[model samples]
Target: MLTYFRQRYPTRIEIDEDGNTVEVPLSDPMLEAKLHIALSTDGRHWFPLNANEPVWDQWMRDPYVRRGPDGVWRILTTGTTDGYNRDASGPGCFFASSKDLIHWNDERTLPLMEEVRDASGNFLANNIWAPEWFYDEENEEYILIWSSSFKDAGWKESRLWYSKTKDWKNFTPAKVFFEPPYSVIDGTLLKHENAYYLFHKEEEFGAKTGERRAIRLATSKKLEGPYQIVDGDLNDGQIVPVITEGPTIIEDPENSGWLLYYDYCMTNRYGASFSKDFLNWEILDDVHFPADARHGCVSKISSEEARTLINEYNISSSTDK
Candidate 1:
């Protein structure tokens, strides 16, 4: 039997030495029904961890996974009926928890905007995309940030909005987190050596450059403060002025360098870059990642936690039949 291979992007370019181009064949369409957890041990080399049940049947995009104080893995993802980012509703972000990432609990939509209002004094948001939380140990507060469009912006511009909470039940008034001259989305923050680094995608386009959705960096002395666009070289000489989003930065546990990963949505794959001083980057090619993995945050977990999840879930690198 001859197997028919389908390309995710029909117009994807592939150049040869002589300047000849070819259409690249990407993923197999046979794997679409298997929605599994994308797990990686080395920030690269990702594999699909099959779930015993079809837990998420709908739109579960931009998943942010982190370990809570109660020693449980919690996930807050953008929830919608059609699995499209533009179709996100006002019920806020979706929430779920698990002890071993095998058996999930408390799966429901969290009303993050119910008690909070926008600049127009309205508590409604047209879209809620990629809700992520950062725990400040010193202040004992959870800083929640997500991309949303407002009535004043005519739902045309997406910006990063934030709220703080000690307990998830009660939240501080939502406010603008980062708004540049243009629009931005998929904001992720990292604190290193008393400085806060914010990574976000700026939505801009020009005649020369089409769909200028590039991941950029900003720095601030405080968590909520006047962050400025990072001066000097950012991508370590990498030409990344377009077609990137969902930048997730984490310190290399094995080394002193930092691993920065972004969704190369143009090619439908994740692209990674490594930096030591946060100014220069070495683009890592051929890093393994899940094909179906979308915008998601990564966290370091204990070895026991990974072992428990693998054992309980019967998770293998390959999809189960």
Candidate 2:
């Protein structure tokens, strides 16, 4: 029992007419849905760059964001603001920028550039999930790594694809990064020590994919490479998660360790853990605290610091409790 230690912040907040903090509600029906977004931080509390706006586009799940060279934050996600209509089977990838993590502007239709149409010239009408944008400083371009099932591609046969973009306005043709011989999804790539490594969920058998998914690692010496798994492997590492999807690694700001965030299951819930290195993960069991909202990605904030923020942000919470 001691292996699991969860602290659920079963409380709610009330904002005033001016959109400022006002009172605390004992219960928040909006909790789960409100916690809906794949919340991120500018190094603090988890939040949406622009939550609930027309520009948002799609279901907006599995977020991959990074700060660009100019200290400007750029976000690329699976879906757009309006999300995917039935006509469009895939939630298209998009670009949004924010100086801070709270406010964001869509680079899709307005301000930034036009939408990325497909080869048919009708725009891609299929599934493209977990998009990772990689910046090549030397090439002065951005490359996209995404899980796509476009044009007759089957879910069980999912593959990773790549494309190039220079000004965020134009995108070149996309081709299969590696799409064969295995059921691989959620291709998250990382550049480490001058090598580029891509991680994906490898299925042993059957179409059932989930939190129990195995994370397979592949590497290429150059950006453009014949990417190969470490030892022709299919996620045979002892530390890397199996049945775990969406592997995101953040280097611990305080030390050399890396904190990894990934999906524990469906339903708005997930888990947090830290790794001494990228290979293994130690789950922060029952370590829940007052997150900015329910189901939001728990930020780097510790339980103690979260308590402080809750006390500070929603003072009336205790009264309602």
Go through the candidates in order and give the C-alpha RMSD of each one to the true structure: 7.4, 11.7
**In candidate 1, which residue ranges exceed 4 Å CA deviation?**
1-35, 51-58, 82-91, 115-124, 151-155, 206-210, 232-241, 315-321
Q: TM-score each candidate.
A: 0.78, 0.62
Cα lDDT for residue 287, candidate 1: 76
Q: Choose the strongest candidate by lDDT.
A: 1
Write the residue-wise lDDT of candidate 2 on 102-143 in tens digits.
467765521111134556655443556566777888798988
Per residue, candidate 1 scores C-alpha lDDT tens digits across 47-164 of: 5544423334534666677777767777777666332233232447777777876577888776666645557765566667778888887798889998776643322477788989
Candidate 1 lDDT at 241 equals: 45
User: In candidate 2, how many Å is residue 147 off?
Assistant: 0.7
Whole-model lDDT, model 2? 0.49
Residue 186's lDDT in candidate 1: 81
